[model samples]
Target: MAFSAEDAKTASAVWEKIYADVEDNGAIVLSRMFKENPHTVSYFKNFTQLQSIPETASAEEIAALAEVRGHGKKVFSALNDLVSHLTNVDSLKATIVPLAKKHATELKVDVKDFGIIFENLLHLIGQKQGGDAKEAFEKVTNLIYEEIKAAY
Candidate 1:
């Protein structure tokens, strides 16, 4: 479905708040994803050893968190790119398609995992920003998912 101007405005406003603390918010979303869906960790090599680590403030644990935070920043940066182009579907698709292909081919990420991440992100938005932000993002997420699915 096409993203309406109003929806874009609403999503952009909510996204601006999230992007203000993109690294932390992205890490929170990704950390939740790993915690809730342990199977997803298989796709992340750096995170594999983390599963074996005990729940203590060890070097490995700290390093893993730092890796997660760094990766989270990249994820949010890509998201910011997409969100900024919401008003232009051509630009959005152009941006997403290559990333989608890379995930499918290079990263070998299961397309379904994208949906899971979106669920976690939506939940975070709902928890922190409330229903309206969540609702707006739901539409944007669906559009993104569709594009990724098509690429896959």
Candidate 2:
């Protein structure tokens, strides 16, 4: 199933809540949410604080998390193509990069932001959870796209 605007809103709201919580406390709300709702843990990445102790996550940790998520997406997409076809699989990057390139002039944000967010989402799901979760992430991306459309 494709993602809806409401789905993006929900995801963004979740993200904002998690981010704000991380800013205010040392804990990640998403991680805690998973512990509280173990059944739904599949929806978010599990991050542990292993470095210097602080009341909240450091900016470096946040940046590293984002990088991990982006890298995870690239790996997940490659794996998906490999599993789907040994010789004639479609390239997710090729498909998505051109779309960003084509619409670079019209997007409200930088074209790279679209790719970065998409990649980050994928990375978070694939590496933190499992590669099988890419479909779910794709649905969320589709929902974000729909929401973006409605906005402008």
Candidate 3:
């Protein structure tokens, strides 16, 4: 979520595109974008690995992720924290937008498709947890998406 102004603009705009596609074509289309794009797949795979405990993650892994969880909470405290950092155009530009472009190229998909896959993967993670973890994860995830959606 270390976005710069341009990254924010790109991410925000791309999110709008993804939402529009979802609104117009639905989740299946979004899923198709992931299936069709390899860059999107790589982006998603990287993001998932970064954010979640791995499939074979041990208790130590869980503990490490727990620390990240606290860091995630701080980001959750402010909605704009999701992309507001993008006000620093250099940082944002350095990261997300390029990734977006790379995602489009690597996956042979649109930036919007990459966005939808990112969003849905988060959704899927939320679905996998139960009770408090589910609730907390969904809340943070929904907040992040809502901000991305609002930027449109």
How many residue pairs clash per model? 0, 2, 7
lDDT of 1: 0.83
lDDT (Cα atoms) of all candidates against the true structure: 0.83, 0.39, 0.40
TM-score of each: 0.89, 0.32, 0.29
Which of 1 and 3 is the better model by lDDT? 1
**TM-score of candidate 3 versus the correct structure, residues matched by position:** 0.29
**Model 2, stretches more than 4 Å misplaced?**
1-108
Model 3, 1-152: lDDT tens per residue? 33445545654553333233332223333334334443443444444543353344442343244333343333223323334444553543443454345434554444355256445434533444434343433433444443434333
Q: What is the C-alpha RMSD of each candidate to the true structure, in Å?
A: 3.1, 15.2, 13.4
lDDT ranking from best to worst? Answer: 1, 3, 2
Worst 10 residues of 3 by lDDT: 71-80
lDDT of 3 at 123: 51
Clashes of 2: 2
* Residue ranges of candidate 3 with Cα displaced over 4 Å: 1-90, 105-107, 130-152
Number of the top lDDT candidate: 1
